[model samples]
Target chain A: MAQKQINGTTIDVNDEGYMTNHSQWNKVIAATIAEEEGITLTPAHWRVLDFIDHDFQEKGVVPGMRRMNKVGGIPTKDLYELFPNGPIKKAAKISGYPKPASCV
Target chain B: MTGSQPISKVSIVVSRGSLEGIYPGLIMANGARMEGIEANLFFTFFGLYGVLKNYNDKIRVATVGNPAMRVPSAKGLPMPTLLGAIPGMSAIATWMMNKEMEKIDIPPIPEFLEMIHDAGAGIYACKATVDMFHLTKDDFIPQMDKVLTVGEFYEQSAGGQIIFT
Candidate 1:
């Protein structure tokens, strides 16, 4: 797929409205969460997608790394290991949450 | 733009310095709710003390080793631990933080937690942090939904963006 840079953040909108850069970690987070919950998905991508969707329903926003760690059973300390670019920002982008202005 | 869909969810992670670090998570969670977003706060390490019922009001601003204090606002600040030993320091700090927040119309921590909860934001205390501090479930504030380990929180956050404040 072709990629374009928008204000330094990559924007890739597919037919399903999915943003590509965030998809990988989203999948990992989702799978971990699903495995923990005893829920199974035939397609790997479904795990992360559904997990984020469920979390949104429960909390009304994409959760950060610590919450993800809580929900996915991943260790917070291991976040940097999971996402080289800083877990919070990377995972958040994939989770469909914009960075808070104060963060910048 | 994502087609005018409201910001429906946000997740914040709290693990750092002192009351200042913890307060932002609470403030953001509440702020998100006000913006029609559901928010969640995950408190770990030093951040856990903020949500601990016994320690909530007992939290003291960190005067030492605080990068924030190196700036103009914190020049000549007294030591927080030392000040904690002194009477009224917590009240003074609370008053100062409240005063500053009030100027911006942000409510206090207790009020913020209330708002966040009412908006469906979940607040959890990090079990590892609790264990490290030798604290029990009863030590946490009433706002807490549960005591969770890091792995447990991850299960909850799953596909959501997870942040560490």
Candidate 2:
């Protein structure tokens, strides 16, 4: 086994080069998450984050699909263009969806 | 609306007295969509006129009450209804708005409206006011969800904070 250094964290990599620690999944990496989803973090994305923060402040929970759909101000095509995979699913995941299973 | 959801949800109520007021709602709603936030706009009273296909063309913002407006020809001039009839008032207003928005890097109104619609923000007109004003579905913009009563608006606004600007 060869040890590799990533962000000051050492990980054992086998011939396959996969990190040895499954616990890494439990960590929150906002930048990595954004990169993984291909989000460029424009003021446009900040607008979404701000709205989500405001919604959470007033409502005490993240909105549901119905509300999300109603708030659907962003074009789905644009969203797909922005996120590629899916803005909603990726956003929900990054925001820590109320229930992960239902989120995806 | 999601309880504990981030205040990131953007809802705007259009109830301004001037053409200027109407544009903010339109711009913000459209901006919200572009940024990936959910946007909802409620057009009430005179604001409904902006969304009316026929009246939309006829709508004008009253400069009389706007402190920001300067009447070069005369001070304290009430926006003569006739001024609204000037052939280019709408175009002028659109131009001014587009210019100001460009200063802040915002897109133009038509593109903004399209983005807002494509993003999924539900646009609604006030049912009671629409009826009171003697307007019908035929008078409204093509994509309006429906004419909603205050009660209906409240139902929609239940989880989200309501903004009346």
| TM-score, every prediction | 0.50, 0.54
For residues B36-92, what per-residue lDDT tens digits would candidate 1 score against the true structure? 455679888877766766556656665545434432245654454544546665557
lDDT for each residue of candidate 2 in B1-165, tens digit (9 for 90 to 100): 557765556668997535676777876675555445666889898787667774564445454434444333334455554565577765665556556555544443434444456667789998878878898888877767788888888887665657787
RMSD of 1: 14.4
Question: Roughly what TM-score does model 2 have, to 2 decimal places?
Answer: 0.54
Task: Write one digit per residue (lDDT tens) for candidate 1, span A1-104.
Answer: 64534434455544433344444334444344334334443443344445555776687666544344457554434443343323444444445444422320
Cα lDDT tens digits for candidate 2, A6-84: 4565645445343334344223343344655666566666555555545656766554333443464544455545554
> Which docking class does model 1 fall in?
incorrect
Two-chain complex of model 1, DockQ on C-alpha atoms against the true structure: 0.02
Location of the lowest summed lDDT over 10 successive residues in candidate 1 chain B: B64-73
How close to the true structure is residue A95 of candidate 1, measured as C-alpha lDDT? 52
Once superposed on the true structure, which residue ranges of model 2 sit more than 4 Å away at CA?
A1-35, A38-76, A80-104, B1-5, B57-59, B71-95, B102-110
